[model samples]
Target: MSNMQHELQHLPASAGLEARTVGRVGIVGASSTGIGIAIQLLDAGVPVTFYEADAAALGAGLAQIRSAWTDTHDSRLALLAGTINFHHLKDADLVVDASETEGGEALFRRLDQTTKPGAILATAAAGAGVDRLAGATRRHGEVLGLRVDRAQVWELVPGRDTSDPTLATVGALARRLHAPAAARR
Candidate 1:
């Protein structure tokens, strides 16, 4: 398995984030972390749209998302069933890219063009150059990086161009996820 998958496999059951009301979320890359986030968001009542360049990869991600909820004895499959779309991504309230794949970059670019100006765009790239990505996109101020690990919850990694409003929004989302609020300086 990939490092991303291995990392997600060891995530603590209570990473401090409880799924709250996520309205609409778009995930790119469909890696282990990507699929995990999609499932968690959907279980929390958010509708999710996933974008994958490979049909088989998309299918696998859908299956993974379903399996996570299924094995947990959560019977929200009916609600979560139709809540997931395995096709082209549409405008969503929030968008998360699990890796620094080209597909993720493309989706970020597209979202930069079409999504509402205030939409949240987060990346799960721990070491990727977030500043460069933000620079290449249209919504520089709204972009942020998220780092997650087994022992802790989401950590916001600020991009060079990130703004205060973006940080505030990230805090709100983290709260909604039941994750600890980002430490304020």
Candidate 2:
């Protein structure tokens, strides 16, 4: 099995999240992390929109997803979309920054400005701390770090200013996505 599939299989159980906790999800970048996350969320019937400045990269990423999808291609594709416009993320309830490039503060600041208030912003950048990312955003309470390790464990790191509600929401989301081992830090 693929590494992504292996990781998905080992996630922990539910965190008592509502069925409709996540209305929509926005992903920045077309990296492997972003595509893996999209697969998991789409399988749970959540709509996912991918934003990439490079149209070619976006297309490649979409193609990669299609190729990796072994079943339920039509339904998953129905819930997937790709865009070059960053503003389109305004409607996302959860925005994950999985860009391979090191955008740092500029990226988080822009994401904070573009997304609607109350939206949760997460990073798939493994070594990037939640506090650093949150420091760049106005929605400090809504910023966190989410990363899946090689062993299939998920780490949900909250910043100092991260609100309890945000942590709960993300925990619920992790459950909905079948990531049972999501531990908060």
Candidate 3:
């Protein structure tokens, strides 16, 4: 069995549910940041779906993942998927937008409409970008910024309207991935 399967097997049913509150993470962009975050999530037994506007970029991202991962078990690999369809992210509990595409405001607005209600929306963009992105979404309370540093620590940056519960949920996810979290206003 793969390491991910072994880890999942040791987890109780309740533990699984609790830890996976942000189940099935979706990442926008096939950028290096997106790929790195995908690796971290997959290593933690979290299913990851990647959305890329460019088909070629999506293919390249998948290739990068396969090449970087030493443990290429089919079962563990099954947890990763790629899509060009924006709607495919509807089922994702958390979405981290790492794309450097144009019209970021439009994209965030689309994400607000496409993602399921209560789904946590995050951006890998720096500075007050999260606040700007949140302004495009109706679900301001559920939107924040997330990025993994070189130390593998997750930095959770909140917008003006970000809620405590949203931070808690993402914090739980960081812990599940065996990464510490730093909160930033």
All candidates: CA RMSD (Å): 7.9, 4.6, 6.7
Q: Residue 95 of candidate 3: its Cα lDDT?
A: 93
Which regions of candidate 1 fall more than 4 Å away from where they truly are?
1-22, 71-88, 100-107, 181-185
* Per-residue C-alpha lDDT of model 1 across residues 1-185, encoded as one tens digit per residue: 65434433333332334433336777776687787766666656666777766778778777777887536656545434322343334457677787446445665676687666567788886676677778768888778777665533666777777776666655556555555434222
TM-score of 1: 0.72
Return the candidate ranking by TM-score, descending. 3, 2, 1
Which portions of model 2 show Cα errors greater than 4 Å?
1-20, 70-73, 150-153
In TM-score terms, which candidate is top? 3
- Candidate 2 differs from the real structure by a C-alpha RMSD in angstroms, to one decimal, of 4.6
> Tens digit of lDDT per residue, candidate 2, span 161-182?
8776776677767656766544
Task: For residues 1-185, write the lDDT of model 3, one tens digit per residue.
Answer: 65434433432232323333888999999988888899889889899999998999999999998777677675668899899999999999999988866437788899889989989889886653777888999998889888777666677787888887787778778778877666755
How many clashes (backbone N, Cα, C below 3 Å) per candidate? 0, 4, 0
State the C-alpha lDDT per candidate: 0.63, 0.79, 0.81
- The clash tally of candidate 3 reads 0
Q: Quote each prediction's TM-score.
A: 0.72, 0.84, 0.85
